[model samples]
Target: MLTEKQVVELLETIYDPFLKKTFKETGAIQEVKINKEKGLVSVKIALAKTGTAEQLQVQQTVVQRLKDAGASSVGLRFAQLPFEEERTTNEPIYLAIASGKGGVGKSTVSVNLAVSLARLGKKVGLIDADIYGFSVPDMMGITERPVVRGEKIIPVERFGVKVISMGFFVEDNSPVIWRGPMLGKMLKNFFDEVEWGELDYLLLDLPPGTGDVALDVHTMLPTSKEIIVTTPHPTAAFVAARAGAMAVRTNHEVVGVIENMSYFESKTTGEKEYIFGKGGGQKLAEELQTDLLGQLPLGQPDWNDEDFAPSIYGEDHPIGKVYMDIAKKIIAKLR
Candidate 1:
């Protein structure tokens, strides 16, 4: 016959989801009551939620552990954990990559930054709020639709990060010409219906320009921040600034700036070429009073290819290195 001490030792094997440790380590399993005369063992396993899959798995595991520990009869009881109130804060620091024009590589920068942040182990989620121009699904190479569990919409995981985009719903190159209210409903559904889980950063790949889409996103996610992307040129900066100004109007913070296709490095010459001219990023940063977050050179080799996702970074590529550096800078700023 198994003693109470052995039962306690076996209960220690269960994993605790939140603490990411053993049940005994997390105090998830409280005291064990043993009735040797009746050949019965009753275990009280503290639960963090009412009906989570985790809780069900925990119970199942408890039964296995109890039997394995030599219990003739076992009874499991669950004690519900008190729910903690969510702390409301206005500063969620949602960084949006946006521009007043398309073909500015806004989505490219956003996807890379989100991936970079994930590589640094920060809880990150990327939303292709661009709706019509939802390049994120293609960029991230995620084809799976979100899993719906009751009221919860589990986000799609790609590159170790949660991502939601319209590209999953629409066909390839299909135009999404939906109007404001309809698009607003979908955007809000993504926010209210989808469970983003806990995230340190949520990078929004917004639609190009200060359109109705931006207005809707600002309404849904007011705590979001904005990151304007432009080329190292005057016209792009002006248009990109307009997008940033729109963010300010919507009460979202414009955190920083990113300049893409700012320059190119010649392989043979080993020299940096200011292909898009200079000072545009610094100029835009100064105009917006935000840091110049990053400057990306023209990526030739990592461009659209059949081998990999279009916006994904090729390992050992220089542009890929720049993304890693930018992600570190973002972490430092957040810290």
Candidate 2:
């Protein structure tokens, strides 16, 4: 059986997730009781907010630590902190890349924008919030999975960007069969459970269309800014306007519109062909009352076997330069 002093010392290392401080620093461990003969321990904790996912995480940590310290069982109780402490941690700018429909290269745009921002020396993180159709990990050529450190999941870093995706959790390219509530819970975990160190921008690659997951993100990050992606086709642009409207309804500032696959350029003749039609990007931007950020030409990235990412474009590639300019515009608008 452990003594009360021993229990207190052991719990001092546990952190209050929201406060980002240890139990000792916050004095959150209000009471500790130890039943010596039965080796049972009970502790009462105080946190900035109770009954949250963070609180549940803290409870699990407390219980596990007590058991490891020779307690047969652990009982935990939580209460809201009496006084709110000013949070000193800097929150990252939340940006969501969305589209009104699928097959518009929304994920491709998302992956490159994150890489472009990182290339510009901005600390960036990307979340594959398109839960049902997660492709970010493979798109970025991230082969490794996130590792658990204490109570937090450390995001995988690639190209100066920290990334978390549902693809890392599933095996053998299996399908996710979860419902809405479960998907929302997993998305919340991406925010609450992942350790994204100081990030200038945190971008969410939302599922195309105004659906449940998108709605959940709008609800969760009330101040998130959104960018609508569309092709130059009239139909694609017409559908994309609905996504912009959804962002407007949620009070998310529509940063700008990006027209992807606007045209195709010939390698031999150096001639440009308006393959998908023209002016759709401008039309959507006008509808959303925002700027037309850029029109991307249809082109494939020059692949490097050494560091091969299927969707990412190099900084010098023509399309890559377009993305860089778009990234700069985004930084300017948001900052």
Candidate 3:
């Protein structure tokens, strides 16, 4: 025979796999009934969403743990909490990466940043919200299109990060010639139709400049923050400032600036050549009142034929280490 307090102590050790919190912390164990004579124990629990594999796992674990704790039989049942409560408790942080112009390695930085964050044990999703100029799929080497599960689009997972891109929908690299309203609608669909299951972060790779798609993203994600990307070129930094300004105007926090291709490093000599000139990233960060998160050197990544992503480096690679450091700083800033 176990006391109610001891039963709760046992239940506290059981964690909800999806929420990553113990049952006691989640207020999941609503009721616990025990019958010592019959060796029966019953628990009523609350779940954020019902009938998912995670919920089923939680139930199974609960029953097994209780049985192991001395109950001959355990009865379990679940009631779903309000939808609003669930969403409010588990909303993901949305971060958009932007540049004032193209050819600054914005998409590359976006892919690697998302991947790096995922490597750091955070659930991450990357949206190629570049719309007409979408290149996340190409840079990521993603060829498979997203799958439609019922009404929701399942984002393709690669390198431990979930990804959705317009490239998956285009035909033969044909241009997306939709008007502004159509573009907005498509961007809306990416958010509304895609089934991103409880991400820790959602990174939007916005098209360079304050274009239709960029504006749409600003409007769609009013609470979203931004990371500005630029090269070390003076002209490039000047243009990137405009993107940072737009983020400010839209009330999005400028988390930091990443200056890509800041230099080229010689492998044998171990010397850094400032091919693009220097100080652009620092200048932009100063102007935006944010940190210069990182300066990425120029070096083509080694590709594997079997891999589906480009510009991806392992955590130990030089560029990969830079991105991981940036990811850590970004996480700290967000916190």
**Per-residue lDDT tens digits of candidate 1, residues 268-314?**
99799997788888898898888998899997546554446777886
- Misplaced by over 4 Å in model 3 are 1-88
Ranking by lDDT: 2, 3, 1
Q: How close is each model in CA RMSD to the real structure?
A: 9.2, 3.5, 10.3
| Best candidate, TM-score | 2
Q: What is the TM-score of each candidate against the true structure?
A: 0.71, 0.84, 0.75
Q: lDDT for every model?
A: 0.78, 0.92, 0.87
Between which residue pairs do clashes occur in model 2? none
Q: How would you encode candidate 2's per-residue C-alpha lDDT over 1-335 as one tens digit per residue?
A: 88999999989878777655668877888998888877789899889888887788788878888899889999888987766453554568999999999999999999999999999999999999999899999999999999999778999999999999999999999999998899899998998888787889999999999988999999999999999999999999999999999999989999999999999999999999998899999999999999999999999998999998989999999999999999999999998
Q: Give the Cα error of residue 263 in candidate 3, in Å.
A: 0.4
Task: Report residue 243 deviation for candidate 1 (angstroms).
Answer: 1.0
- Per-residue accuracy of model 3 over 1-335 as CA lDDT, tens digit each: 77778778888756555454456767877888888898988888887778887788777877787778788998888998666646666668999999999999999999999999999999999999988888888887887889997547899998889999889998999898888899898887788678787789999999999988889888878999999999999999999999999999989999999999999999999999999899999999999999999999998777788874577877888889999999999999999
Q: Point out the higher-scoring one by lDDT: 1 or 3.
A: 3
